[model samples]
Target: MIVTVQPTGISAADVLAVARGDARVELSPATVEAMAASRAIVDDIESSGRPVYGVSTGFGALANTSIAPQRRAELQHALIRSHAAGIGAPMPREVVRAMMLLRVRSLAMGRSGVRPVLAQGLVDLLNHEITPWVPEHGSLGASGDLAPLAHCAIVLLGEGWVLGKDGARMSAAEALHGAGLRPLDLAAKEGLALINGTDGMLGMLLLAIEDAAHLFAMADVTAALAIEAMLGSERPFLPELHSIRPHPGQAASAANIHRLLQDSAIMDSHRDDLAHAVQDAYSMRCAPQVAGAARDTLEFVSLVSSRELVSVVDNPVVLTDGRVESTGNFHGAPLGFAADYLAIAAAEVGAIAERRVDRLLDVTRSRNLPPFLSPDAGVNSGLMIAQYTAAGIVAENRRLASPASVDSLPTSGMQEDHVSMGWAATKKLRTVLDNLTSLLAVELLAGVRGLQLRSPLAPSPAGRAAVAAVEPFAGTPGPDLFLAPVLEQARAVVAGRALRGEIEAAVGPLS
Candidate 1:
């Protein structure tokens, strides 16, 4: 599919598609016209004989300094070279692609006073799969992902490192040549426009939101499996009960759980049986409430991502009129808050899932299941340590969930004080999301084991399919083996592969 970046708007799904390398990006003619018009304003400003913030003057603390016309090109080049100061590991290729796509989307709006060719350079990189080696750190995510994006912008200037179109180490010049493109000689205001935007953080947030949607749904699917394995009731998920709360996420989660738990012999047998307690543990009883909150967080972050997709974020953006103005539209507090909030909610989902795994393993609490789901109870140690792994990840998430946006530090000689450390928040969020998947997978593996032990009493339709989806790799449980391979496979299934789809097929699309 082709994703057309217009002057007016773009979609979250389109961004995801570009990130995943599933779609091509086309810059609309209107976007090209807009860029030309905006560039005209910058050209006029440069000729006006007055120093503008980014066009003629130096950046940040150096704003008062002006460059001679002969050295203005050098100034743009120097800005990119100096600001490409990021350290540590390179960003993943998909993240780079997403960020590049968003940067192009912003430029297409023509509010950044950059030329059409500059935006096409970004689109061309995506088209040919030439990913710049962007560092994961260095951006405060205000003044809009400056350092990270400079690393990307320098690639377009053919002065930075990139994995070439063929995915081998190469210089940016070599890569762009192969893509039938040239290194740009950046014009006035062009360099600042290239490097100034929320693309880096916002791109990751968009992809994370997409991943979280699937993981959030799987949270419910796996939670149902755990509940059924432990013979917990689904009465808490009744529409009558959820209708009172009316939170969209809570209601949706309840409906999914209710669908997954429908027509269960285990639940039916325990519904009236006095052996079971009046209710299950909060982990089991309130799965919807917890996972639902995460779902809601995902929704809010999506809203932010969508709004950001359409916004022109930069310092000294070009106005629709002939005026050029400096503004704080580049601030990342909105994205920072969303990313941090999501980490907290996603961590809780993992936390609750870990608790359920603990319950399924402890004989006293598991009701009838063997300790650790061990076949021999004393020697096998089946999945006992896996629970520990899950616990550790959940515990780590508690710290990662602490808001990074609240902590501020001055930069650029205190001219840019009270900065938002959103990049740190988002970088940590990536880890939390990965850990959440693994935590849920351990619960899934344990729950399936418990269900197998139940014998003659099979799971509900959705639960049966959910188990079937992973059982091929997780295997029928037994004594100790190299369980890591199996656990990783189960993690893949729960993180979003075949299991959820199998369950949806059986129960009809899980709400």
Candidate 2:
């Protein structure tokens, strides 16, 4: 089914469906008429023969340069050609698709003065699974992700390369012909309209936000399994304990942990402090505080994305009264700051999770599980290197979590100085989220194996179910085996692609 584009609204889920999932998108009837209305205004400006910023005059430092009506069409092509200067490896295909989807959504708002065919061309490219060969670099993330979006725009004109489904690069013209569509002859201001929004950074943020939401839930699940496996008390996660501080995310995480560990004989076995340490390490003791902080950050970022989804982020937006006025709505400062904050939170989540995995490996720290959770510590190395791998990823997250938004370089001959670098923020945020899921999965795998080692002491029903949910991916636990594959299996579970539904089946909706 198609996701109908509306003027005032679009949701993150809707973007994900069209961008990542195989959902087609099109302009609603009202949006089609709206585009016609906005396009007519641009035609009037063109016939008047006066220079408008992006409509007839040059861009950025060259804004004072004027073009005659005969050369106006050439001006649009030149704008796209010069700005399609991105260099680096190609960005992930999913992000490119999302960027395309969002660009069309922005156009569908009818403020950019683009014709319907321009929007339809983007939809056609997406529907045909033809992704523009968008480079990973470029985009100071202000002036609307110019470099990256230009790569996308170039494909619309049949002038650049595109990625086919078979992972081969083909000419944009070939891709368009195969998809039964034609290249756009960009109308006035349409070139600036294509590359002049926050879509590139905004698209990455939407997917990262979605990924973060799932992994944050997995954090609670893994933290619960870690708590029971380590013989930690649930008193710290008590609803009454959280009510005093009253951070909604904290309360929610604590409640989930407490509920998942319910009816556990392992927890019951240590109810009176019969054998285990009186307290857990900070990684175990402070699960909710760290994870909950990340959860709250996720919520904040989502709110920002939700606002951006419905916004008219174009520069020189066309008002209802036919006034085209330059505006700074194209600035990416909001998204830059939000993505940076979430990256910090995500890195911490990984850091703490890695500590827990290390603790589970250390016999002295594991509260009497075998060394590295291996029964034969000398003969079998167990997950010692697996913990190392998680630690390495955690360290990388630390490196990546440094705020990209804080760093700016002057561009457009200093006419556009002090960029948000939001594209950089969202790019690294994706990496941090990836590392976070792996870190949590390492902890979950070790925690579950440790739980199995405590044979006579049964886990809570939900805990057992979590273990069962990952059982296929995690494989039958034994002495040392190929640990990388085992962790990869568990990572899928923690990433919520595999076990979330089954675990939620046994427990309930998480977060």
Candidate 3:
């Protein structure tokens, strides 16, 4: 696949294709022309000798200092070298690729006053699979993800470490040489333009949103399975019930649950008994409500991500009228808030799932299922420890759920006093989602076993497919066997999308 980045914008799908799928990247002709036009403005400003923020002047706390015209090239080089100070372990390959693509997309909007070749240098990095070895720390997210992006920008100058096409660490010079590409000689405002944006956080946010979207869909499927396994009433998911509240996400979830439970024999077996407790517990009955809220939060986060995608988040933007102006577009508050919101929402999803898993393990709550759904009760120990694992992850997720955006410290000699910490937000969001995936996998294991113990009483067609999908990983339920591998295999079923795929194939697409 070839993703032609336009001046207008790129889509989240395109970003994923290039970042995760190694799709080739190309700058649209219009983007090239737009970049050339913007560069012309910077050149005129450079020769005129009037002081500009990133053109003739120094950066950050040194903005007021003027530079000799002959030393401007050195200034750009110094900016990249000095700012490439990120520390910690290297980031994942896909994240670095996404950040590079987003920065190029921002420059392609023609407001960063950078040359076409500079933007193409980034594009070349993507196309050739030359991923810069960016460290995991050193971004305040105020003046963009400075340290992280500068780590990337240094590669453009052939002065940083990189993972070559074979994914082995090497010098940027060596990687560029192998790719038959030359290092760019950045001029004037190019270095500042390269590093000054919310690309890193925004890229992480985009990838998280995509992953969350899939997991949210899987949340509905697993919730339906849990509901069936517990012999819970499916009435709460009635469209008419959710219609009154009318939240789009809620309605979609309710509809998914409703369709997933259609004609379910496990539910049908108890329909005649009004004595089956007046209603199910909140975790069982209100699955849609909780997961629905997460869906809605993801939608809002995606809206913020989409807007940032099309926006030019440079420090001093070049105007169509030929004037260069400094603005606060680089601040990451919006991305920070979005990433934190997603973490909280995802944590809630896991919280409710843990509750449901706990219910399945306890004989007091799980109706007639043996303790821990163990076939041999005390001797087998069954899935008792699985609930413990789920609870532990849920507790950790709650800590990760604390909004990173709320905590900020001054940086750059108080020049950037109120930093966004959005990078921290996105980083924690990844952990939250990972925990959520594990928590849901626990629910899948317990839920499927609970359904199995309700012997001879079959589940819905969709539920039957779900059981088949997991039985291989979970094994025949009996005396306790080696369980670590079983639980890990079940987690693969949940995280790898096999369970959702089987359920959907049996019952068509879910909401």
lDDT of 2 by residue, 410-478 (tens): 988888987999999999999999889888888888888888888878898877887787667665557
Task: Kindly give the stretch of ten consecutive residues in candidate 3 with the minimal lDDT sum.
Answer: 163-172
Candidate 3 lDDT by residue in tens digits, 1-511: 9999999989999889988999999999999999999999999999999999999999988999999999998999999999999988888898999999999899999999888999899998898889999999999899999999999999989889997556567899998898999998989999999999999999899889988998898888888888888888888988899999989999998899888988778889888887787789999899899999999999999999999998889989999999899999999999999999999999999999999988988899888888999988877899888888889999999999999898899987788889899999998898899888888888888888988988798888778887898787677689787878887887787778666777778788887
User: Where in model 1 is the C-alpha error above 4 Å?
Assistant: 164-169
| Weakest 10 consecutive residues of candidate 2 by summed lDDT | 470-479
Task: Arrange candidates by lDDT, descending.
Answer: 3, 1, 2
Clashes of 1: 0
TM-scores vs. true structure, each candidate: 0.98, 0.97, 0.98
Q: Residue 397, candidate 1: how far off, in angstroms?
A: 0.9
RMSD of 3: 1.3
